[model samples]
Target: MTEDIKVDKVVDLKGMPCPMPIVKVSKGIKDVEVGQVIEAITTDPGALADFPAWAKTSGNEILKTDQQEGLIKFYIERKA
Candidate 1:
């Protein structure tokens, strides 16, 4: 679960649309150490697809994801 993941950095993408959400998450990943988890919090529905694509292309691992109400949380571990 996301609650058990130790987050090294958190990026809030609330209200951001499309590419911005993924753009910010891409940048956020760089701020963390490899193997450290970065938590991305977003309200954008597009993040549902963006996050997974990012994890695949970047070779990082998505440790967990939680969604409720309108908020989405992604716990990603840096691999690169």
Candidate 2:
């Protein structure tokens, strides 16, 4: 399901640590228009939990989450 999501923006936060991943995602999401999707690629383990929580609080919609090896990918759609 996540594999089919089309992303308008890609934020590569690989190698970055906690908060920073979400921080970059937060900043990157602003570049995309509402209803557009943003894909954040991060190596931080915490992102698995943080992205969903952040999306919930920020009103963004999380379309998908994929974790492969140590990499985490989040497909987020800006709701506002």
Candidate 3:
């Protein structure tokens, strides 16, 4: 299901660490409308925690997450 998610925007935070990945996603989410999707690609493991936490805190929705070989992709939908 996640593999087929359509993305309105793509934010690449590769090589960034810690909060930066989530930070970029935070800004990227704003580029899309509510119900639209943004795909955030990052190399930080922190995103495993940060993304979900941010989605909950910011009232956005994480439609899907894909992780492989240290790469992570977040499919987020703006809810608010």
Candidate 4:
């Protein structure tokens, strides 16, 4: 049930470095409505560590994440 999600924003964070992808995606989705989705595609390994931590601290929801061919896709829902 955690594998599927509907996203409102799709951000391509591929090829970005550790904090950059997280920074940009965090900034990018700040204005999204509550419960709106943000999808991030990243190649940085940091996203795997950073996003879950970010979600926990920021109170957002990590809906889903899928990895294929070294690309990571994360679906997040804004909490407030």
Which candidate do you rate higher for lDDT, 1 or 4? 1
Q: Per-residue lDDT tens digits of candidate 3, residues 7-69?
A: 899999999978788778888888888999998899888788888999999999999889889
Top lDDT prediction, candidate number: 2
TM-scores of the models, in the order given: 0.93, 0.93, 0.92, 0.89
lDDT of 4 by residue, 1-80 (tens): 54457778889988987788878878867968988999889999878899999888888988888888999988889996
Query: Tens-digit lDDT track for model 1 on 1-80?
Result: 55677888889999987889889988999998888998889999888887898899989988888998999989899999
Q: Which clashing pairs does model 2 show?
A: none
Q: What range of 10 consecutive residues in model 3 has the weakest lDDT sum?
A: 17-26
Candidate 4 TM-score to native? 0.89
lDDT of 3 at 35: 92
lDDT of each: 0.88, 0.90, 0.88, 0.85
TM-score of model 1 (CA atoms): 0.93
Query: After TM-score superposition, what is the CA distance of residue 20 in candidate 3 from its true location, in Å?
Result: 1.1
Model 2: runs farther than 4 Å from truth? Answer: none
In model 1, the worst 10-residue window by lDDT is 1-10
